[model samples]
Target chain A: MFATKLKTQLLLITILPLLLTIAVVSLFILFDVLDSIESEVIKRGDSITDQAAVMAEFPLYTGDVDALQEVADLLIKTHDLNYIRFVDVSGQLLLTENNGNDKGRLREFSSPVFSQAPDLDDFSAPAAVRAPLGSVDIGFTDNSAEAQRFSAYIKVLSIALVALALGLLLVYLFSRRLNEAISSLMTTAERLEQKDFTARVEENGSGELRNFQRTFNDVIASLEQNDAELQQKINAATASLNESVEQLSEKNQALAQQRQETIDLERSKAILEERERIMRDMHDGIGGQLVASLAMLEREQDSAVKENIHAMLTESLNDLRLIIHSLSMQNNVLASLLADFKYRTSRRLEPLDIELDWLVAPEADSLSIKPQTGLHLLRILQEAFTNILKHSGAGEIRFRAGQQQEDFLIEIEDNGEFHPDTEAMSRGLGIRNMKSRAEKLGGSLNIEKISSGGCRLILTFPATP
Target chain B: MTRLLAVFFLLLTVLSPVHAGSVHIVLSADSDSHLQAASDIKAELEQQDAPPPVTVRLLKPFQSFQPAADDLLVTVGEAATRYVSQSYSEHSQLYSYINHMALPEPQAKHWASVMLDQPLQTLLDSAVDIVEGRYHNKLVIAVSEENQSMRLQIDQLTIPDSVELEVLVIEAEAEPAKIIDQALFNAGALIALRDSRIWSGETAKWMLYQSYKYNVPVVGYSQSFLKAGALVSVYASLRDIAHTTAQQIIGWQNNQGRLTQEGILYPRLSIDYNKNIARALNIPLPESMTAGEQNNVRD
Candidate 1:
């Protein structure tokens, strides 16, 4: 609402005084002219009255009304007098004349009809003491003065109005140029707010306004130049940042590939370590025992003892074969390893004249286990089969493998019509060894007699464990 | 011939100094009238075939004068005349330019004065002539009480039968307006005297104003009064007095250091008319009076 305050202020500053000065000067001139007209009218009236008095002095003193009338008539006719009257010193009107042209206002002037003494040239001479024979009163009208005053007023007012109008026109023209300059600056300023630094005001107008426009344009130009330099710096920084990010990404990929190769090398080293451990255990346990048994066989005296030595030799050889078979398996599938173990055990049992029964569930055949768990399960099965072959006089041995929920279950049964003492079996090394192997496999082991009078051994472990 | 000529030049040069008697003229003031009278006297004395050595001097207060018995002393104006009369009684003194009423009586046989005032009868006759029979046969004379002798003199004069002279003796310190009003009442004309007590300062102005108020013409004693609204005035002009004084000095010098006229001698008189005042009063002036040698008509 107050946006155009400068324009309003500028117009007022220029026009108000112009209007006031014109009005004041015009009024002064009008009053002066009017006063001059009034003064002229009064002076003319006084002059005519004085002349009439001088002419009527003798006539009025002599009481000659005719002569007084002539003097009054001559004055009234020649001058612009409303009326003329000659009055004697006794206050009696002797003669009166009127031009009959009374209009507008009237101003009356009077002079005594003095019988003036003679003029004296002497400096010390006394002032003339004249008798007032009578008086002459003349009436003059101000109609002409009023007319002239009216004409002057019209002229003064017209001139004042014209001057005021001219002043307003000039002010408006000058202020328009100034406002245009200011508006242009404001518009450019708004553009600068929106960050359009290229915006600039036109250098228009004169004097200070023109200088202001030029200064604004110079500032905008400087800002535009600065913005261009800033944009260039930002672009250069962005490009440098993109290049750095791409190099970091390549370095991360190379580091990831090197980490993956190191992990594969660690896994191969662990598998080789497990194989060396298994070979060392075999060299120290079964290989040494075979050497001792050969020595004993060479020194045996009884034939039955010789047969025992031959049986021990055959079991060791069978254990060695089972170890070889387990080592040669491609994957750690429990069913494949268990099937190999059943074939090896059946051959050993057939030499001993015992029947072999093997049942492998399909779900149990796909179950995978760690290599160490497979070795523990095979060792436990070997211990149970040897016990069945040597201690339990069993004619047939049954083996079964299946899955129950998340667990894998394996059962081995022997039917030999022999009831082994529980306490004695618990104390036996083979039974203890079998139990120890089952515990290592993270499973449970149980030995019991079935209804058909055969011993049953059950092993249960988690399939993923 | 050379011897006779040398003897004659010697006798002429030696005798010229013996016959040259100096004349001293004393003035009352450095006033133009007094100076003019003194200069005229000196000039007239010098114009003689055997003129005396003349010197003019201004009279100082309380100053004494000692003149040779053969040397003549001329005093101009009232102060110088009075001063020389009292201080140098035995000297041959000629007093000029003093008012006739103000002149002192002669103390020696050769002492004389040229009076400034015109004869009273001459002033009255001029007043009569100015009225021109317009006023109702009445002429008023205004004088101060100090000058009762002047009023008596006017009473003793033989006035024209057509003119009735009325004398108004104004008292000293009295209101001049009342006196003038009384004097102008029913009078056709007023005659102003030379008495300063009656007609000087504001009293003089009141007299003129009352004279106009009554429509009465005033005949004054001096030219100044004539200019001051008087219809007519009769007096001795300064030139007339100066010429008479010069003639008297010449006569005294020629008559063996004694004045030709004795006592208070009146100078040649002059009459001046205010034509404008005469016309304003509706008094017609006779052509004979206007065309006279002594008449000076001021329009």
Candidate 2:
């Protein structure tokens, strides 16, 4: 029945138009149904109920007993209400339910509304509008106007259904064999969209529809097949962008750190270099003087003097040494770096016996890369090791660096916990600094959990080319 | 007394009829015009004072044998069985006139034949010629009486894009007789409503897209047709023409249970009928006749 030439094409044509039509129709019908139901149901309330209440109350207040009764009874009968009564000041039962205010509840405000209403006299004489008479309450039972709305809704639904069925049937027969072609094309197109580019629509239905489907399929297949190449390009572009962004972020952080360091220097505002020279002089040249002073205290047996000289002089020399090291020689090949790194790391991690393994690959020994690159690599490794020590509870870790194919590769693996929760990883300085260092050298890094258990940090850097 | 009067009149009628000469009026049995002629004569003669002794003879629509070296064109009644049976024996009778009847709308044919004392052929002839297409080598317009023949070709040459060749069946052979014209008109109307843009496009992709994404209704007579991409159709009716012809026989006879001198024309129901179609085609029939799917009408 749906035998279309280009099965997929005709199918798409039939389906899309039909679907668009149906969707539009359904939305239209739904809104239409809602509007009708709302208007009609509310209309039901506004028209009959509103009218009955307004009209019935009018005569009741006008002091015309007969007219009031007639109006009340009419409203009651027309709308099928239950009771209509009035009350007056008499405390007598004159006008009952059928009558007027002669027999009803007391007209006092304080009267118990829940109790049966008192009575009063029927309207008489000048018809004083029945005194601010008791209230008039009119109501309808539980059959709200929802029923009408529901029926209208049902009618709309059925009509839409039947119309849809008929429309489909017409296209089927009229198009006949063409539908088959359309269907086959559609199948092929679907497969193509799912990344099956090899799929081709059958060019077998009506010639034109078939050709249409086949051509479309061919185009889609090509587009799909080329997706891999496209992805490669996109990924390369993305990598470049990410590298730029990372460099920018690191520059910004460095600028901020420089500003903070300058601020700290201002606060500490001292010629620490001059102070270190003075301290060195004081230590080397005045050392004998301090020692002789301590000796005089001991010889005189002045414990107070001895303790004061010992504690004060001893603390001064240590501070002087710190100042000298910080201000003077920032570059010390063997002892300086090892001692600095050791002191810094040990000071940080000694409290927790976190293990640290440092391995230099063949390339580091060969020194093909600049010393700065080596230093940067060392910093990154240090940052990673610090992270492992601070966060990774793993009992063991391994760090290895190598060079292959004119590329430098570094691997850092930890055995304990692989990756910390992402929230924790995102918040810290450890990962950020490591990633920035890697990008600064035109290298990429992948941090992933190893299947064998734990996390691996793999960094590969391209050579100058 | 009433019984005796009836008996006496009946006896007198029998006795008087004993010597009356009989005129055997032979006609094409199922031919619409001849059927009309038969009914007209029957009504007229029935009103006459003692109708002349008469016997109306009826023959099949198609005849097989050659007419004794003197015959002219064969009527529809003579065209049938005659071709198959290969015999043409007992056909001579009173004067016969073969009327040049036009095709009528299906609705008109139905009401005229079933609910009214009118021939369907007259109705078919009255329908307007709308869109023209060749069907069975005859030009057919979307009409109410029947889906007359119309030819459609959707080869690669017709359109700019991939050509789609599809066959539209207004009335398939399944029903073969119950002619429901309104249904077919409905299908044709739907077809006419489609934008001309549907003719050309990459056929398969569009179709799959439409079916899955749009859930568009495919016009067809049955689920398969719909599955194959047909949206609607009339149920089995019009295709059963032979059965309908036989069924219409009851409507042809008079109160005396005798066939009318004029032949009767039966309405052909299509596989696609709808109520709006009757109005569109200007056929005066009750609206209840539209019980079918919505499918395209092809002659």
Candidate 3:
């Protein structure tokens, strides 16, 4: 299957009819001209016959063979005759003249010759009366007709071929221009298919093709404008959608933050209410026992047993005061609470033969402490000071408090004679009580023997606790 | 009163016969030949024993002229014949010098013709005289296809002495030379009838030439044949036409303008001979033939 392009097909459609019409018209013209020439030649042949017959009449009447021969020769020479003959009524040849050429077709005409002036008064009239003396037979050659036909054929064929070639050239030129225009339009259409709206074609050629090119360009322009407007609309819609999403995300985050804050506020309120209940329970139960024991012991003095009892009762009362102070401190500032504990501790240490070293950081002033956590830290501190007084036998005590990596560090040291391998010291109630208080506050208390013959106790916990 | 009325009616009847007895000749002549023939007919009519009071009306084309009732119309030539036959058919018309007569309706009885051409009998009789009783009874007459009616009339002739009439029919598209050659074969004498196709142009010369070749004589219808080597020619002269036409009128007049079977008659004719042709053929003339019978001779 051979493929035909639009241009070739259009050229074929235009050229075939033109060529066929030229061929048909040429054929018709050739045939008509040939027919007309043949008829005229035949008419010429008949005219020659008539002329020769008239000239031969007097010669035949008088039986003048020389005159008849002269007339025949003259006719053969004057016209394009192949042969001329004069035959009498008895089929006798009287005179004949021929050109000795018979290659082409022949046209023959025969006419009778008679005496026009027969003597009506003479009874002995000649025998050329009621019969033709002789008939002139003239033969004309058709070479001219043949030559004319050949010439006409050649002329017609030449004209037909020229016309056909000219028609094809015109068709080809027209089709080529048309195809170029169409190709441009097709290329534009392909570009438009690929979403490129800026494609255009030149408005070349004439008439409808030019109009089509202009129309296609206009359509592409309209499409480009529409595409730009559409892109703008899409960008606006995307921007609005992004803004809506961002606003929604921000609102969701704020709502979660507020919900978390509300939960923290509820938890803090519950913790404060629990701490007040614990303080009331402690004041009503253990606070009355401490005050009664002290009063009883003050009346029994002067004996060694009674003096020992009085000292123990005074220490128990101080210990109970310390617990109350740690539980009752309000403002929740660790540094201020530590300052009050230091005043009491320094007063107790003054009655002994030891000097207290206090080191508290200013960062502690902004640190907040829970009430239960404060009580646990105060118990651990008191146990350490009491042990220093009763068991350390050191001359001075050093206490330090500061923040260490998100935790509060407290250190207490004493200058005393110490032993590392004493099971009694590890199992002692005083040291165990300090360890229990440390565990309760989510902190660790460590005791180490100092190289300078004193013992060190360290406490560490988160500052917020 | 009845006897007196009868006598007055009888007188009127007798007076009407006297006026109606006068013969009226309505002459419609259109050509010089017809005018001459008309005068000849008039002169011949005046010589009658009882000539009628004649009325000569020379009519022109498309002109209407009514003839008196009971008058005889002398229509000369074809134009006169056409006018009187088409216009005044109720009157009795006697046509003369008409080369061809149109036949009237079989029921209509007023039309008759005196033919301008000699009758077939006259031509045949002249043909027999030229034969001089030689070659027994063979006579060949050639007629063209158009004049087959003349051949039919010739067939009705009462030929004498068991004469065999060989008719040579000339076809419309035949070669004249071939027909003439065929007509002259084995014939005592040839009669070339007056036919446009068989005796026109060079045909007359061809016929005479063929007759000379066959050593036969041809008796034709025109005196031109005598000069053209025919043995004899029999043709009706204008005087003969006038004399025959007058005779027909007299016959009709004697019978009170009533047309008769003799109304159609052949005109008298003159005979011409070519003496040189007869001598060349070596044919003998009849002893009773006189110089008076020889109207003209071309040596």
Candidate 4:
């Protein structure tokens, strides 16, 4: 943008004043020369006319036409006049001579011939007063003077044109140099914008342009040096940042390993706790019954006692099988654990002449629980069955398990005597054990005597623990 | 004897008229010369023992005049003489202040005139006096074709043995410079005659210019020429002509009212000199001519 603008500006600066001066000076010279030529022609015409008037006085006074004619002819031929006429004082033409050169512009000059008288007072001096005898009229052509003026005009014009051309050439050469210098600076500036600090301009031209070149080169050199220093600082900063990033990555990997180890240690500790809890339950429940059965066999050898001992051994094996089934279940499905409990309880109920009605909804069968939660739920159901078999003596029982809104519900209903001591039975060890196990499963258990001479036990828990 | 002689003379004187017929002086123009001649004539007639009653009258153009046949009519200038001679053909007339060339022909037996021009002998003598042995003793004169009578008069003059006279007759239409140039060639003096065709106005100026260019002194016929650059002038003065006219009128009265002179008369001549022109031309005047009362010398 700047280069194009400067080119036009430089051209105007150089050529405008030169053209104006040449035009004005040429016009002035031409006008002056033409005016001078015209004046000279008029002066020459006046001189010739004055001489003719003096020579004509004698002939005019004597009324000599031939003498007047001869004077007119000689003057016309010698001075290149178009025509000459001698007129008397009354304006009558006495004699006239012409050369037939009356083709172009003409200027006429006239002078009066005066009658001379001798001065009586001063013998050597002519008289001061005179009377006009006649006049001589001369017609001078402007052809020669016009030709000279035209030649002068051409010469001045030619000189002006040649001078203007030379001036234009010099202006073009100088402006071109200036444009080149400015263009170099512009190119270098554009490179500087693109972060190419190595770009520089050549120091050329004169005066202000030369100074501008040097200043621009100095600025570019400073920028290049600064850019190099900044690049070095940036490289140092990048190296330091990379080292910090590497250290951070290593620290993050170590933290991740430590976290995984801690997680495994927590899981192992939890599993060991669960195993100890299972061993304590078996020792407390099945081991105590087995020891009592053995003691009774040792004391009495009756047939009924032997049969009771065999039943006790079978019950302890069933409890062991239920615990193993709950522990082996996948994802701790509460329905599978519940089904295993029912199978064992139903067989026990068949021997006791009791009917068991089991109903499990599809959603209840697909319900998932934690392994510990499933084990707690299975223990809760077993406790309920044991109480029914030993105390309530119900002939039939119904069990139902399904989802209710955002919670799960399990119902166990038995047709049994409505004992007036139901509140006392809820305080029994089996019922307390079921309640404790239900609390551990994140659920609740309730046993109540129904109005229909049977009892219902309900367990409800949230769907997601 | 004294008583007898005195009675006889007294009887002769008693028969003579105490005054002649009245003298009438008529002027042609009211010019100074004509008026002066009339006054002189009246004065001269009054000086007589018994003078006539002179009545001076100016002649008007186209006016009638009938003079007494016996009266002596004294006409001044050429115009009054011509008019009186034509109108009163038989009247006794005496003409004064008239040139000889312009005088009227005498028709009456008693008419006479005192002419203005001097004789050729007198003009030549004045020219010789001005030349004074300079320029080879030669004299030059120019005359126009109209003045052939004057040219004949010049040819008839008795020129002196020591002098050579050259006469040039110019044509009426010819160039005067060529003729003047030829006349002033190595001449001692140039004699200028009073001819309107050859020597008047611009022609006269040219002649004077040529005369100066040739260094020849000019002898002119009038006082004006002397002032105009002539070395000497020979002409008749108006006072001399007036005095001459007074003499003729007295003579006519004395001769019984008839002019004593029968034909044209000549006045006494006067000469004038321009001392400056004489010094410039290196010519000397004769001592006698310079000392004369009529001689006039101007710077």
Compare the candidates by TM-score and give the number of the best one.
3
Better of 1 and 2 by lDDT: 1
On lDDT, the candidate that comes out on top is: 4
TM-score of chain B of 4: 0.84
Q: What share of the true interface contacts does candidate 4 keep?
A: 0.05
Q: Rank the candidates by lDDT, best first.
A: 4, 1, 3, 2
Question: In order, what fnat does every candidate score?
Answer: 0.07, 0.00, 0.17, 0.05
What TM-score, to 2 decimal places, does chain A of model 3 have? 0.53
Model 1 chain B — which ten-residue stretch has the worst lDDT?
B12-21
For model 4, name the residue pairs that clash.
Answer: none
Give per-residue CA lDDT, model 1, range B177-277, as digits (tens): 67667767778788877776767764565578778868898887788876688887777777677777777777776787777887777777677778898
Model 2 TM-score, 2 decimals? 0.19
TM-score: model 1, chain A: 0.48
For model 4 the TM-score comes to: 0.39
Tens digit of per-residue lDDT, candidate 1, span A330-360: 4368877887777777777777788887889
Model 1 residue A26 CA deviation in Å? 18
Q: Write the residue-wise lDDT of candidate 3 on A336-395 in tens digits.
A: 778888988888788886898899998898998866677777778877887788777888
Provide the TM-score of chain A alone for each candidate, in the order shown: 0.48, 0.27, 0.53, 0.50
Q: Output the lDDT of residue B295, model 2.
A: 22
- Residue A256 of candidate 3: its Cα lDDT? 91
lDDT tens readout by residue for model 2, A231-341 = 899999999999999999999999999999998776435554555566578667676566666566567655776678776865454444443333333422322433454
lDDT of 2 by residue, B187-222 (tens): 222221111122112221133223222222222222
Clash counts per candidate, in order, are 1, 183, 18, 0
Tell me, by DockQ, which candidate is best: 3
